[model samples]
Target: MEFLGIWIAAFLTLCIYSFLYRDNPFYRFAEHLLVGMSVGYIIILTIYFGLIPYAWDPIQKAVTGEASRWGFLTLIPICIGLLFFTRLSTRHAWLIRYPIAILMGVTSGIMIPNALQTDIFAQVQGTLNPFSVIGTLSSFEIFGAILIVIGVICTLTYFFFSVEHRGPIAGISKVGITFLMIGFGSAFGNTVMGRVALLIQRVDFLINDWIGTIF
Candidate 1:
Protein backbone atom coordinates (compact mmCIF):
# COMPACT_ATOMS: atom_id res chain seq x y z
CA MET A 1 0.00 0.00 0.00
CA GLU A 2 2.85 2.41 0.82
CA PHE A 3 4.62 1.61 -2.43
CA LEU A 4 1.37 2.10 -4.37
CA GLY A 5 0.85 5.53 -2.73
CA ILE A 6 4.35 6.63 -3.68
CA TRP A 7 3.83 5.63 -7.34
CA ILE A 8 0.46 7.37 -7.42
CA ALA A 9 1.95 10.59 -6.01
CA ALA A 10 4.88 10.44 -8.43
CA PHE A 11 2.50 9.98 -11.35
CA LEU A 12 0.42 12.96 -10.25
CA THR A 13 3.56 15.09 -9.89
CA LEU A 14 4.64 14.10 -13.39
CA CYS A 15 1.15 14.90 -14.67
CA ILE A 16 1.38 18.41 -13.15
CA TYR A 17 4.97 18.99 -14.37
CA SER A 18 3.88 18.05 -17.91
CA PHE A 19 2.24 21.51 -18.03
CA LEU A 20 5.75 22.96 -18.48
CA TYR A 21 5.82 21.43 -21.98
CA ARG A 22 2.26 22.46 -22.91
CA ASP A 23 -1.32 22.18 -21.68
CA ASN A 24 -2.58 18.60 -22.22
CA PRO A 25 -5.10 16.04 -21.00
CA PHE A 26 -2.76 14.74 -18.27
CA TYR A 27 -2.37 18.19 -16.69
CA ARG A 28 -6.10 18.88 -16.87
CA PHE A 29 -6.95 15.53 -15.30
CA ALA A 30 -4.44 16.12 -12.49
CA GLU A 31 -5.71 19.65 -11.89
CA HIS A 32 -9.34 18.54 -11.76
CA LEU A 33 -8.50 15.57 -9.52
CA LEU A 34 -6.62 17.85 -7.11
CA VAL A 35 -9.48 20.36 -6.87
CA GLY A 36 -12.11 17.65 -6.47
CA MET A 37 -10.13 15.89 -3.74
CA SER A 38 -9.49 19.19 -1.96
CA VAL A 39 -13.22 20.06 -1.97
CA GLY A 40 -14.19 16.58 -0.72
CA TYR A 41 -11.55 16.70 2.04
CA ILE A 42 -12.68 20.17 3.13
CA ILE A 43 -16.33 19.08 3.33
CA ILE A 44 -15.46 16.07 5.49
CA LEU A 45 -13.21 18.17 7.74
CA THR A 46 -15.89 20.86 8.15
CA ILE A 47 -18.53 18.30 9.12
CA TYR A 48 -16.47 16.26 11.59
CA PHE A 49 -13.92 18.71 13.03
CA GLY A 50 -15.63 22.07 12.64
CA LEU A 51 -19.46 21.90 12.53
CA ILE A 52 -20.06 18.84 14.75
CA PRO A 53 -17.63 19.73 17.51
CA TYR A 54 -18.23 23.46 17.67
CA ALA A 55 -21.80 23.93 16.45
CA TRP A 56 -23.73 20.67 16.73
CA ASP A 57 -22.23 19.50 20.02
CA PRO A 58 -22.84 22.83 21.74
CA ILE A 59 -26.46 22.88 20.57
CA GLN A 60 -26.97 19.27 21.74
CA LYS A 61 -25.48 20.07 25.16
CA ALA A 62 -27.70 23.11 25.52
CA VAL A 63 -30.86 21.12 24.73
CA THR A 64 -29.91 18.37 27.23
CA GLY A 65 -29.13 20.96 30.00
CA GLU A 66 -25.51 19.84 30.00
CA ALA A 67 -24.28 23.30 28.94
CA SER A 68 -24.43 26.82 30.39
CA ARG A 69 -27.30 29.18 29.49
CA TRP A 70 -25.05 31.06 27.03
CA GLY A 71 -24.47 27.81 25.10
CA PHE A 72 -27.97 28.15 23.58
CA LEU A 73 -26.66 31.13 21.57
CA THR A 74 -24.80 28.63 19.36
CA LEU A 75 -28.14 28.08 17.59
CA ILE A 76 -27.95 31.67 16.25
CA PRO A 77 -24.78 31.01 14.27
CA ILE A 78 -26.09 27.64 13.11
CA CYS A 79 -29.25 29.28 11.75
CA ILE A 80 -27.14 31.95 10.08
CA GLY A 81 -24.94 29.19 8.56
CA LEU A 82 -28.03 27.41 7.20
CA LEU A 83 -29.05 30.69 5.54
CA PHE A 84 -26.00 30.31 3.24
CA PHE A 85 -27.68 27.33 1.54
CA THR A 86 -30.52 29.61 0.46
CA ARG A 87 -28.15 30.90 -2.24
CA LEU A 88 -28.80 27.69 -4.20
CA SER A 89 -32.49 28.53 -4.70
CA THR A 90 -33.30 31.42 -7.03
CA ARG A 91 -36.49 32.43 -5.20
CA HIS A 92 -34.86 32.34 -1.73
CA ALA A 93 -31.48 33.78 -2.77
CA TRP A 94 -32.30 37.00 -0.94
CA LEU A 95 -32.10 35.08 2.35
CA ILE A 96 -28.37 34.50 1.71
CA ARG A 97 -27.73 38.22 2.19
CA TYR A 98 -28.32 37.92 5.95
CA PRO A 99 -25.35 35.54 6.45
CA ILE A 100 -23.15 37.39 3.99
CA ALA A 101 -23.84 40.73 5.69
CA ILE A 102 -23.19 39.23 9.13
CA LEU A 103 -19.93 37.68 7.99
CA MET A 104 -18.70 40.87 6.31
CA GLY A 105 -19.79 43.16 9.14
CA VAL A 106 -18.16 41.00 11.82
CA THR A 107 -14.99 40.58 9.76
CA SER A 108 -14.65 44.27 8.97
CA GLY A 109 -15.36 45.25 12.57
CA ILE A 110 -12.60 42.93 13.78
CA MET A 111 -10.04 43.75 11.08
CA ILE A 112 -10.34 47.54 10.73
CA PRO A 113 -8.75 48.48 14.06
CA ASN A 114 -5.97 45.89 13.68
CA ALA A 115 -5.31 46.98 10.10
CA LEU A 116 -4.96 50.61 11.13
CA GLN A 117 -2.70 49.74 14.07
CA THR A 118 -0.39 47.44 12.14
CA ASP A 119 -0.33 48.84 8.62
CA ILE A 120 -0.75 52.57 9.16
CA PHE A 121 0.17 53.62 12.72
CA ALA A 122 3.09 51.20 13.08
CA GLN A 123 4.44 52.22 9.65
CA VAL A 124 4.35 55.93 10.60
CA GLN A 125 6.10 55.17 13.89
CA GLY A 126 8.80 53.12 12.14
CA THR A 127 9.40 55.75 9.47
CA LEU A 128 9.75 58.78 11.68
CA ASN A 129 12.25 57.94 14.43
CA PRO A 130 14.22 61.11 15.25
CA PHE A 131 16.66 59.30 17.53
CA SER A 132 17.63 56.83 14.77
CA VAL A 133 18.31 59.64 12.29
CA ILE A 134 19.61 62.48 14.53
CA GLY A 135 21.33 60.61 17.39
CA THR A 136 24.58 58.58 17.22
CA LEU A 137 24.43 56.34 14.15
CA SER A 138 26.63 55.20 11.28
CA SER A 139 26.58 57.36 8.12
CA PHE A 140 25.08 54.54 6.00
CA GLU A 141 22.27 53.84 8.49
CA ILE A 142 21.41 57.55 8.75
CA PHE A 143 21.48 57.92 4.98
CA GLY A 144 19.16 54.91 4.52
CA ALA A 145 16.69 56.25 7.06
CA ILE A 146 16.75 59.69 5.42
CA LEU A 147 16.14 58.09 2.04
CA ILE A 148 13.16 56.12 3.43
CA VAL A 149 11.64 59.30 4.93
CA ILE A 150 12.02 61.15 1.63
CA GLY A 151 10.56 58.24 -0.34
CA VAL A 152 7.55 58.10 1.98
CA ILE A 153 6.95 61.87 1.71
CA CYS A 154 7.24 61.75 -2.07
CA THR A 155 4.89 58.74 -2.33
CA LEU A 156 2.29 60.42 -0.16
CA THR A 157 2.63 63.64 -2.16
CA TYR A 158 2.03 61.74 -5.39
CA PHE A 159 -1.29 60.49 -4.04
CA PHE A 160 -2.32 63.98 -2.79
CA PHE A 161 -4.86 64.95 -5.45
CA SER A 162 -6.01 68.13 -3.73
CA VAL A 163 -2.95 70.05 -4.90
CA GLU A 164 -2.15 70.23 -8.60
CA HIS A 165 1.06 68.47 -9.62
CA ARG A 166 3.18 71.47 -10.78
CA GLY A 167 6.67 72.91 -10.10
CA PRO A 168 8.19 71.12 -7.03
CA ILE A 169 5.23 68.73 -6.78
CA ALA A 170 5.98 67.39 -10.29
CA GLY A 171 9.59 66.52 -9.37
CA ILE A 172 8.49 64.94 -6.07
CA SER A 173 5.83 62.89 -7.86
CA LYS A 174 8.46 61.69 -10.36
CA VAL A 175 10.64 60.58 -7.44
CA GLY A 176 7.62 58.81 -5.97
CA ILE A 177 7.10 56.95 -9.27
CA THR A 178 10.71 55.69 -9.17
CA PHE A 179 10.29 54.47 -5.57
CA LEU A 180 7.01 52.78 -6.51
CA MET A 181 8.69 50.93 -9.39
CA ILE A 182 11.54 49.77 -7.15
CA GLY A 183 9.04 48.48 -4.56
CA PHE A 184 7.07 46.65 -7.28
CA GLY A 185 10.27 45.07 -8.66
CA SER A 186 11.32 43.92 -5.19
CA ALA A 187 7.87 42.36 -4.53
CA PHE A 188 7.97 40.52 -7.91
CA GLY A 189 11.45 39.19 -7.21
CA ASN A 190 10.31 37.93 -3.78
CA THR A 191 7.31 36.17 -5.39
CA VAL A 192 9.50 34.46 -7.99
CA MET A 193 11.98 33.39 -5.32
CA GLY A 194 9.13 31.90 -3.22
CA ARG A 195 7.84 29.86 -6.18
CA VAL A 196 11.38 28.63 -6.99
CA ALA A 197 11.83 27.57 -3.35
CA LEU A 198 8.56 25.60 -3.41
CA LEU A 199 9.58 23.91 -6.69
CA ILE A 200 12.95 22.91 -5.18
CA GLN A 201 11.26 21.47 -2.09
CA ARG A 202 8.84 19.40 -4.18
CA VAL A 203 11.66 18.10 -6.41
CA ASP A 204 13.72 17.17 -3.35
CA PHE A 205 10.74 15.30 -1.87
CA LEU A 206 10.23 13.34 -5.10
CA ILE A 207 13.92 12.44 -5.33
CA ASN A 208 14.50 11.55 -1.67
CA ASP A 209 11.15 10.21 -0.45
CA TRP A 210 9.57 8.53 -3.46
CA ILE A 211 12.38 7.63 -5.87
CA GLY A 212 14.88 6.72 -3.12
CA THR A 213 12.42 4.29 -1.55
CA ILE A 214 12.63 2.02 -4.60
CA PHE A 215 16.20 2.48 -5.87
Candidate 2:
Protein backbone atom coordinates (compact mmCIF):
# COMPACT_ATOMS: atom_id res chain seq x y z
CA MET A 1 0.00 0.00 0.00
CA GLU A 2 2.86 2.39 0.76
CA PHE A 3 4.51 1.59 -2.60
CA LEU A 4 1.19 2.16 -4.37
CA GLY A 5 0.81 5.53 -2.61
CA ILE A 6 4.35 6.45 -3.70
CA TRP A 7 3.50 5.66 -7.34
CA ILE A 8 0.30 7.76 -7.14
CA ALA A 9 2.20 10.67 -5.58
CA ALA A 10 4.92 10.49 -8.25
CA PHE A 11 2.30 10.55 -11.02
CA LEU A 12 0.50 13.58 -9.49
CA THR A 13 3.82 15.44 -9.02
CA LEU A 14 4.65 14.85 -12.70
CA CYS A 15 1.13 16.01 -13.66
CA ILE A 16 1.67 19.29 -11.79
CA TYR A 17 5.18 19.79 -13.19
CA SER A 18 3.90 19.18 -16.73
CA PHE A 19 2.70 22.82 -16.77
CA LEU A 20 6.36 23.85 -17.19
CA TYR A 21 6.19 22.43 -20.75
CA ARG A 22 2.71 23.81 -21.65
CA ASP A 23 -0.81 24.08 -20.25
CA ASN A 24 -2.68 20.79 -20.69
CA PRO A 25 -5.40 18.58 -19.23
CA PHE A 26 -2.94 16.76 -16.91
CA TYR A 27 -1.90 20.02 -15.25
CA ARG A 28 -5.47 21.23 -14.95
CA PHE A 29 -6.54 17.93 -13.41
CA ALA A 30 -3.71 18.11 -10.86
CA GLU A 31 -4.42 21.78 -10.08
CA HIS A 32 -8.13 21.24 -9.58
CA LEU A 33 -7.47 18.10 -7.55
CA LEU A 34 -5.13 20.05 -5.24
CA VAL A 35 -7.60 22.93 -4.73
CA GLY A 36 -10.57 20.63 -4.25
CA MET A 37 -8.70 18.49 -1.71
CA SER A 38 -7.49 21.56 0.18
CA VAL A 39 -11.01 23.05 0.41
CA GLY A 40 -12.53 19.75 1.47
CA TYR A 41 -9.86 19.27 4.14
CA ILE A 42 -10.48 22.78 5.48
CA ILE A 43 -14.24 22.19 5.66
CA ILE A 44 -13.75 18.97 7.61
CA LEU A 45 -11.31 20.69 9.95
CA THR A 46 -13.69 23.61 10.55
CA ILE A 47 -16.54 21.26 11.46
CA TYR A 48 -14.53 19.03 13.77
CA PHE A 49 -12.08 21.49 15.30
CA GLY A 50 -14.05 24.73 15.26
CA LEU A 51 -17.79 24.24 15.10
CA ILE A 52 -18.13 21.07 17.15
CA PRO A 53 -15.61 22.01 19.82
CA TYR A 54 -16.48 25.67 20.28
CA ALA A 55 -20.16 25.87 19.30
CA TRP A 56 -22.10 22.60 19.30
CA ASP A 57 -20.47 21.07 22.39
CA PRO A 58 -21.06 24.12 24.49
CA ILE A 59 -24.70 24.38 23.41
CA GLN A 60 -25.18 20.69 24.12
CA LYS A 61 -23.62 20.98 27.56
CA ALA A 62 -25.86 23.88 28.47
CA VAL A 63 -29.02 22.10 27.38
CA THR A 64 -28.04 18.86 29.18
CA GLY A 65 -27.19 20.73 32.42
CA GLU A 66 -23.57 19.62 32.24
CA ALA A 67 -22.45 23.29 32.44
CA SER A 68 -23.70 26.71 33.50
CA ARG A 69 -26.29 28.78 31.61
CA TRP A 70 -23.47 30.94 30.20
CA GLY A 71 -22.70 28.09 27.82
CA PHE A 72 -25.95 28.93 25.98
CA LEU A 73 -24.42 32.28 25.06
CA THR A 74 -22.47 30.41 22.37
CA LEU A 75 -25.67 30.58 20.27
CA ILE A 76 -25.19 34.35 19.93
CA PRO A 77 -22.01 33.98 17.89
CA ILE A 78 -23.51 31.04 15.95
CA CYS A 79 -26.44 33.23 14.91
CA ILE A 80 -24.04 35.98 13.91
CA GLY A 81 -22.04 33.43 11.86
CA LEU A 82 -25.22 32.25 10.14
CA LEU A 83 -25.89 35.86 9.17
CA PHE A 84 -22.95 35.55 6.74
CA PHE A 85 -25.12 33.29 4.52
CA THR A 86 -27.64 36.15 4.17
CA ARG A 87 -25.31 37.47 1.46
CA LEU A 88 -27.08 35.02 -0.86
CA SER A 89 -30.41 36.95 -0.47
CA THR A 90 -30.60 40.34 -2.12
CA ARG A 91 -33.19 41.84 0.22
CA HIS A 92 -31.51 40.63 3.45
CA ALA A 93 -27.87 41.10 2.33
CA TRP A 94 -27.53 44.10 4.63
CA LEU A 95 -27.68 41.72 7.65
CA ILE A 96 -24.28 40.39 6.63
CA ARG A 97 -22.73 43.80 7.28
CA TYR A 98 -23.37 43.53 11.04
CA PRO A 99 -21.28 40.36 11.33
CA ILE A 100 -18.63 41.78 8.99
CA ALA A 101 -18.43 44.98 11.05
CA ILE A 102 -18.17 43.02 14.28
CA LEU A 103 -15.51 40.74 12.78
CA MET A 104 -13.47 43.70 11.52
CA GLY A 105 -13.75 45.64 14.78
CA VAL A 106 -12.88 42.64 16.93
CA THR A 107 -10.05 41.53 14.63
CA SER A 108 -8.54 45.00 14.53
CA GLY A 109 -8.81 45.37 18.28
CA ILE A 110 -6.96 42.08 18.76
CA MET A 111 -4.39 42.55 15.97
CA ILE A 112 -3.43 46.20 16.42
CA PRO A 113 -1.57 45.67 19.69
CA ASN A 114 0.10 42.52 18.33
CA ALA A 115 1.17 44.28 15.15
CA LEU A 116 2.55 47.21 17.09
CA GLN A 117 4.48 44.93 19.44
CA THR A 118 5.96 42.77 16.68
CA ASP A 119 6.55 45.23 13.86
CA ILE A 120 7.28 48.53 15.61
CA PHE A 121 8.12 48.02 19.29
CA ALA A 122 10.17 44.85 18.79
CA GLN A 123 12.11 46.32 15.87
CA VAL A 124 12.90 49.50 17.78
CA GLN A 125 13.99 47.54 20.86
CA GLY A 126 16.29 45.29 18.78
CA THR A 127 17.80 48.20 16.84
CA LEU A 128 18.45 50.19 20.00
CA ASN A 129 20.31 47.32 21.70
CA PRO A 130 22.94 46.50 19.06
CA PHE A 131 25.78 47.38 21.42
CA SER A 132 24.37 45.22 24.24
CA VAL A 133 25.75 42.14 22.47
CA ILE A 134 29.29 43.52 22.37
CA GLY A 135 30.45 41.76 25.58
CA THR A 136 29.09 38.31 24.57
CA LEU A 137 29.40 38.28 20.77
CA SER A 138 32.53 38.08 18.60
CA SER A 139 33.79 41.13 16.66
CA PHE A 140 32.20 39.89 13.41
CA GLU A 141 28.82 39.41 15.16
CA ILE A 142 29.05 42.93 16.64
CA PHE A 143 29.90 44.33 13.22
CA GLY A 144 26.88 42.53 11.68
CA ALA A 145 24.61 43.99 14.36
CA ILE A 146 25.97 47.48 13.66
CA LEU A 147 25.37 46.95 9.91
CA ILE A 148 21.78 45.88 10.66
CA VAL A 149 21.25 49.07 12.72
CA ILE A 150 22.64 51.21 9.89
CA GLY A 151 20.51 49.40 7.28
CA VAL A 152 17.31 49.91 9.30
CA ILE A 153 18.00 53.64 9.84
CA CYS A 154 18.79 54.19 6.18
CA THR A 155 15.69 52.26 5.05
CA LEU A 156 13.45 54.30 7.38
CA THR A 157 15.12 57.54 6.22
CA TYR A 158 14.37 56.64 2.59
CA PHE A 159 10.67 56.55 3.46
CA PHE A 160 10.79 59.91 5.31
CA PHE A 161 9.40 62.16 2.57
CA SER A 162 8.79 65.00 5.07
CA VAL A 163 12.47 65.89 4.88
CA GLU A 164 13.51 66.92 1.36
CA HIS A 165 16.20 64.62 -0.05
CA ARG A 166 19.09 67.12 -0.35
CA GLY A 167 22.87 66.68 -0.05
CA PRO A 168 23.48 64.35 2.96
CA ILE A 169 19.90 63.10 3.00
CA ALA A 170 20.11 62.26 -0.72
CA GLY A 171 23.31 60.28 -0.22
CA ILE A 172 21.80 58.41 2.73
CA SER A 173 18.61 57.72 0.75
CA LYS A 174 20.71 56.30 -2.11
CA VAL A 175 22.41 53.97 0.36
CA GLY A 176 18.92 53.03 1.61
CA ILE A 177 17.94 52.15 -1.96
CA THR A 178 20.91 49.77 -2.19
CA PHE A 179 19.89 48.08 1.10
CA LEU A 180 16.28 47.76 -0.15
CA MET A 181 17.45 46.12 -3.39
CA ILE A 182 19.65 43.71 -1.45
CA GLY A 183 16.73 42.76 0.84
CA PHE A 184 14.41 42.21 -2.15
CA GLY A 185 17.05 40.17 -4.02
CA SER A 186 17.65 37.99 -0.93
CA ALA A 187 13.90 37.35 -0.57
CA PHE A 188 13.63 36.39 -4.26
CA GLY A 189 16.65 34.09 -4.02
CA ASN A 190 15.18 32.32 -0.94
CA THR A 191 11.88 31.79 -2.79
CA VAL A 192 13.68 30.37 -5.81
CA MET A 193 15.77 28.10 -3.57
CA GLY A 194 12.61 26.80 -1.84
CA ARG A 195 11.07 25.87 -5.21
CA VAL A 196 14.34 24.26 -6.33
CA ALA A 197 14.39 22.21 -3.09
CA LEU A 198 10.89 20.88 -3.80
CA LEU A 199 11.90 20.05 -7.38
CA ILE A 200 14.98 18.19 -6.15
CA GLN A 201 12.85 16.18 -3.69
CA ARG A 202 10.47 15.16 -6.50
CA VAL A 203 13.37 14.24 -8.81
CA ASP A 204 14.99 12.18 -6.03
CA PHE A 205 11.74 10.31 -5.41
CA LEU A 206 11.37 9.58 -9.13
CA ILE A 207 14.92 8.33 -9.50
CA ASN A 208 15.48 6.51 -6.21
CA ASP A 209 12.07 5.53 -4.84
CA TRP A 210 9.50 5.04 -7.65
CA ILE A 211 11.88 3.74 -10.30
CA GLY A 212 13.69 1.55 -7.78
CA THR A 213 10.39 0.08 -6.58
CA ILE A 214 9.29 -0.74 -10.14
CA PHE A 215 12.61 -2.33 -11.07
Instruction: Indicate which candidate wins on lDDT.
Output: 2
Give the per-residue lDDT of model 1 (tens digit) for 1-215.
98888889989999999999999999999999999999999999999999999898998898898988689898899999999999999999999999999999999999999999999999999998754557677878888888999999999988999989999999999899999999999999999999999899889979997888889
RMSD of each: 2.2, 2.5
Clashing pairs in 1: none
What ranges in model 2 sit over 4 Å off? Answer: 132-145, 161-169
Task: Look at candidate 1 and tell me the lDDT of residue 38.
Answer: 99
Q: All candidates' lDDT scores?
A: 0.92, 0.93
List TM-scores for all candidates, in order: 0.88, 0.86
